[model samples]
Target: MSENETQAEVGTTRRGWTASKVLIAVVLTAVVTFGMTALLVNILERRTESAQPNHNVVELSDTTYDPAVWGQNYPQQYESYLRTEEMGLTVYGGSQPIELTPSETDPRSVGSSSRLEDDPRLRIMWAGYAFAKGYTHARGHEWMLEDQRYTVRVLDFNQPGTCLNCHASMPEVYDELGNGDREAGFDTVNAMTYSEATQHASGPVACIDCHDPDTMSLRITRPAFVTGIAALKASEGIEDYDVNRDATTDEMRSYVCAQCHVEYYFDGDAGNRLTFPWAEGNHIDDIWKYYEEDGHIDFEHEITGASILKAQHPEFEIWSQGVHADAGVSCADCHMSYDRSAAQKVTDHHINSPLFDANASCGTCHSDDAETLVNRVVTLQDRFVVSRNQAFDALVSLIYNIEEGMANGVDEDSLDLAREYQNKASFYLDFVYSENSYGFHAPDYTQSVLIDSMDASRMGELALEGASREDLEASEVTQKYAQDIEDRSDLEFLR
Candidate 1:
């Protein structure tokens, strides 16, 4: 009886069901298509952004990064850096600031006595710079931040922002602010007005010290290094940083740190840029050749301003000339040695000398009692002491003569020659003292370096004798270095 109505209702129901199925398919297809597009866009965006900067750097929120987060980001380096704070083992490189054998009392059997006691000679040579005020051999990474603060306080009261160049986690400074800090906008930190960078400065150093947070890969974040290297490269007729770039793991270790801890000079250019004179080369004689041999340097032997070549902590550079660096042992490889224990795995922050982890360090290469390796360094250190004392004698005498010459009308002409001696003597002394006999990282290299230090000191005395006092007085170059001891009596530099 209701056949027609039943047929019509069935067809309508069937049509409704077909429409619902079509809608469902369209919605599912749209969702999936959108999802794929979003994913591709994300991947492409990352690629495009990274393409602009040859190095894809990631930023770390220093204020927010936790130990776990850091471990995830940089298991090797993060853990390694943390180990820098440990206080185990010998003082190795740890700070005994309060009890550090007073410089004068330090054993003269090794170069430590020269490094500590005779630091006053540097005060005279560097009258216009901070070193004249005071400088000490570094203890470890822990002291970096502390040293920065202490140095700033002890140096010029009118010091500019350039003071932050090597100490603080300056990458954070440059990022939080712009690159207008001392390393960027400087000819002199004491020039113009002092920067207000103190408020923005962070700790001595941290993960950002040698890494780009984004990629957790090593990168040079200091502008002084970038610009300094450029000046050096340009002077040497090189164009790319790739020339000095490390291609392997070993070289990168020390080279990464050398990117900052290097000798540098400020240019008289517009920015008075902090420049590294590495263009000619990175050796003692090589850098000297560029500074003096080429006749490109400024020299005015004024009591307050001496045409100068500052020697930075060439730990890496010196290490490079040593057996460990030659063998491809990096600074990280030794200084930041790792260990696995029973319950929890821990990377130490109490980093000091590799002596603390002798097995982890020297053991990786030569298998021997650490005492044997340390003894080699001590023996070399002992042999070098004779030369160190000699160099100290020569430097002290030359500095005194430089003062007397000014009084006797001898003139400041020979001061540059005097400085060359100073530079070499310093390098030799540095290598000897920095070898960390306890670390056993580079015993052979340490031995050879002490010998070199002794030789350089003798050579310095010879150079001082050869230069004319007349020439020193006449060469009143752009920058003048102090030559008179009596005139500088009140300078408040080291005693």
Candidate 2:
């Protein structure tokens, strides 16, 4: 072909590609938009015969922002965005000034607990990872991105490209690093590090927390979830995540928040940063069952590269199985309760525990007095709290025993038993403690903790039996307790 003819062909191909790209971008941008956002309104209309208010929304005076824009489109959101900065020192769950201590709050926590006080089995379980270095719970979305940004040497973050999928500004990552190729951007950032990419992320969880600012619509910013859903569908030969059909409006209320609230982990083994084991189903048993069956997990130290299964907060999913979700209530319905103004309305974005505002959260639905509902939640919470309290104490003892076995040169069998006791016991207790809802509010989970704790204690006794005291002392996994790696023990590590 002539050079002129070749150039014409090239131009034609480029034009086709460009058009396809634009079309794809527009369609994708629309898919993730939030359906619950306040309806858009025309501001400059005179009191006329045809104008009608269709939604319950607040009336705006002239201009705070342009509704046509994305980020600036939601002034109500912008106004409520400031709540993240509010002081919640006293607010146990959602209050701002949350200074948590593993010891002060729950002395039986992983690092602080007496049960895991000195067991080295975890070192094996979390081999070659920072979790081995010592992991803590204060790492919220806000904190994880900060220190990681300033750190010189960062995490391997490469174990699963899926780790960085959602904990980022999807658009920005997709742009600077992704080269504007939607598919390529996901691949690039999926493989990027929290440390390397954090320099690019500065804002707290907000509009882009679970959405793309290019459109003021709710969108799934996490690739792991998006891909997970697709993979789940593929595995089952299904392809529908219209979030709408999966649940009710109330379920979406919480599922919307669950968009960020539930448990998840970087699946290094599969090289896929997958969400929980939900493909099998969504309850605690279902997810755990999926994990056990697929073995899709890190199973390694998150920091030092050990094998481990990092159980994220399964509150939303677990709650979905509870009376709240079963009754058709959502996390948003309670947490982001709504209020109205100028005939317009909006759900509060403060995002706090419902217990803080009983009337708005519980009273709105149940035909009970504020005190009664408060008592109901508290009663449920307290019931489990008691069992959990016992479980916590038991777990602490289990850790100490495992540490004792390692320290006392116990036999291999006994040492193994000690390790098992501590790991399972502590993990079980921590799982319940971490649930965002207090026990009464999330009863089954609370009960599950107690049951699991009992199992851990039982198994712990077996680990203690695995080793002779002398052998345990010689082992590296346990060397802290030179005395009494024996019969039943007590939890006293934090003290």
Candidate 3:
């Protein structure tokens, strides 16, 4: 009776074990099958994404002045574009956010640090000009319009609508002013007062300024740049050259930026028409020659009593002379490097110095690590600063000498000659100084300009010591073009 009971219990135990094995096998098989299905689904989804094109959610046109509108169709780019509002500093450039005590005159509670306060010499350099009244470190694209509106230069002084050309989105304003004719609108706006012209602008620079809405391709929209580039090409013996038509995609990448970044002046004779003095060429020497022939003087120095020329930011001109330009590297290549967003690759819209993200920006071309690339940039900048400071000091000394000479009753003719020298030295120094790159754009070229500036200052000092005009004459090239200097006495400062 015991054997039969034991055998029955053993058989029951074996059946229980076999049933547990079957249950475990079923669970394992189900888990593996589920994992494989999930992987297959992910692969299919990615493949579909790769094959599909970007779907436009909304129609865009010339009048689309709001970046947010463009963002609807290109969310990845728009998201990056919004980052321009994020303020931070690099080694030598980029804006540092500072707290501003909001006042009745300026409602801004935040702003970039003041370049004038950082270096008082700038005030002296720009004295008798609106820039002396206000000059601050530049913020990103998002702040372009607001910063221009609130700056003391615009607040206390009179400026033409030309100032708004680069600071704000001009397409809508141009359309409104010219009754749908952008060029005609550009002309009318340039003639209006800054306060008046600014009323027409809807916002700061937007996608419309740089892109063709239908095709999403880069195009030049600024009239000043259009004419300027044409003049430059004509000088190079290319007749009727048109930037929008002639420039390649790579060239357009840089040209779009050059529209606002180069040196410019207002043509007062033509209703204060905003103009780029690119008729001669884009180099500093070419620009000086063009100004000499045009006889354009920015202002008369309050302290030195010399006709002074103020240089706007000349990034494009400087960059054109740099090695990177020779290598065919466009501004977008570094500042707006391409990035992968899910299945799509798009240009980053957070426009800032490449140093901020060297890996994404410089690492594309250079094999070096991010830190090394950044360090290289800083090193170039450090050398530039050293040279710039020396040239600046010399120019300041010349200014003081001219002032002292005037006060001490130096001969009128001698003082006049000294003043002329001061003008040359001042302009040359200002050209390099106002450049945002701090000379990193063209190190050797910048240094050469500084050397000429120092030489000009020395000549001015010699002139103060009663040196004859012949003794203080400039280079052969300058001497040859001496008679071309135009009389701008009748011209009024448009500021």
Candidate 4:
């Protein structure tokens, strides 16, 4: 009896031991699984933190115009912003500091003996304008103030305070003007002479231009941009629109850049007030119409007495016509590509062409590698340059013919008509010349504008002289340009 009872108790004890072991194993497995997951999560969090920039150094003031002051708070952003001083030139465009000595001042010495001299034709095209004094490619934001200050165009002091609108830290100038009140500084600065305004000029395009200090949010600080955005909205029939209040975040990404990278003129009636001619539209022809309707001319040509308009770098307007804008890509998307450093991701403040950092800029979206993307951009630029040269040639010939007619005692009435054509031709040509993108922003739109310029120039030549359109078109330059245009005509447009 004792053996049977002992055996039953041992079997039950064995079963209980087995069940306990199984339970213990299940609990241990659960614990290990949970521990591994926690460890993995912790590693990921550290990696994320390592990749992000998280500096909170200082409280930036609303009136802070010094990039150094802003840099103290956002070191990564400030460091990148400082990169704008890097002046590496590409084939069609980028930045190169030009030195104009006393010897290089002669208009005839351009592009021949002087490395910095622009094309010889620019001298005649911009005759009677400040540009004829000097023209150079724009560099980074760091050089904005320095370049404008040293340019021969500013030596005579003929330009007004409005000229500093794009070149200097407007906020710094405004602070001085408004006695520390940035809001009031704008109007005060606008009323000053170029000589006086430059006294307060600060280096580079600063943070205050595009950011709100209190919140550090991207904002439009320039008064002209505020007005221009409103006008742009009004033209689009968007009622009650205000940039400060109504613009979307994506819109601001592009709008903030539109502040300086646009076409503008100084008002004659309002003491040369900085103005965007978007009163009509942003299209090339639209601006042309704006000048005619407003009877605004940048300068009266010395030789032909033609009142001509100078096209500023209208990157924003031209980009608006491109595929990037259509696809909702903002200027900052390419130019100010997001950068990662020290566990921080900030918008690259380099503010340069996409070509500068193709991988980060174009590679983010483009399936093509950097080399292919660059080649594509170069191809577009090459097409633009060919047409651009042809337009230049036609305009130069037209200028010569008009001058000849004026000298030959062409009737005042006919000369006036010819002058009008000259204005159109010059505007068309200058539109291409001043644009920094080399028509890559809107290839189709660029070609159309150039063709118009070429046609108008030829017409002006014909009007001044008895030469037929066919005769004008038969030139080697025109023939070569026409063929290039034709070849690109069928190619799919980026816009």
TM-score of each: 0.62, 0.64, 0.85, 0.79
Clashes of each: 34, 60, 0, 7
Residue pairs in clash, model 4: 50-343, 51-343, 51-344, 52-343, 52-344, 53-343, 53-344
After superposing all C-alphas onto the true structure, candidate 4 shows an RMSD in angstroms of 20.8
Error of 4 at 22 (Å): 73
Candidate number with the higher lDDT (1 or 3)? 3
Candidate 1 regions exceeding 4 Å error are 1-83, 86-93, 99-129, 152-155, 179-195, 227-239, 242-246, 293-306, 340-350, 405-495
Please identify model 3 stretches exceeding 4 Å from their true place. Answer: 1-48, 51-53, 340-343, 474-495
Residue 207 lDDT in candidate 2: 53
Give a tens-digit lDDT track for model 3, residues 1-495. 243543353233211224565675457546655766666566557658675433344557776566666886687788888677667799998988777776888766667998898889988888899998788888788778778888988999888888999988888889989999999999889889999988877566778899999999999999889899999999899998989899999999899999999898989898998889889899888999999999999999999889999998999999999999999998889899987444567889999988888899887789999988888888888988888788889889988988999889999998898888888888889998899988888888888989888888888898999988875564645673454445444647521
List RMSD in Å for every model shown.
19.8, 14.4, 18.4, 20.8
- The lDDT of each candidate is 0.50, 0.50, 0.83, 0.75
Candidate 2 per-residue lDDT over residues 1-495, each given as its tens digit: 343543343233211124664665456445433332423323224213343332223322211122212333455655664443333321234422223233332321111111122344444434444445443333323333332332222332333345454444345555557675645666665565554555444334545444433433455545555554554444456666544345445444554466556677655454444455567666555655676677654443322221235455667666755777667776777777777333445667766566767787776677787777777777776677678767766655565665566677767656554553455555556556656565644687569756876676756665567644455334333553444454225646532
Q: Put down candidate 1 lDDT per residue, 1-495, tens digits, no spaces.
A: 143532343233211124664675457546655666666566558757653221211224533222323444345545565444333334334343332322332311111112334345555545555555555555555345444544433334555456566666555456545454524333333133334654455455666556545654566656666665565556658666552353345555565676666666555554445566666765555666666754444333235233545555556545655666666677777766555442333334455666655676666566888887666555655655555556556645655655665466543545456555555555455434443442234445544555665555555454456644344334334323335544676778834
**TM-score of predicted structure 3:** 0.85
Choose the strongest candidate by lDDT. 3
Q: Per-residue lDDT tens digits of candidate 4, residues 354-469?
A: 88668889877888988888899999999998999899998888888888887888777666767787899889878877888999989999999999998888677666665444
Extract clashing residue pairs from model 3.
none
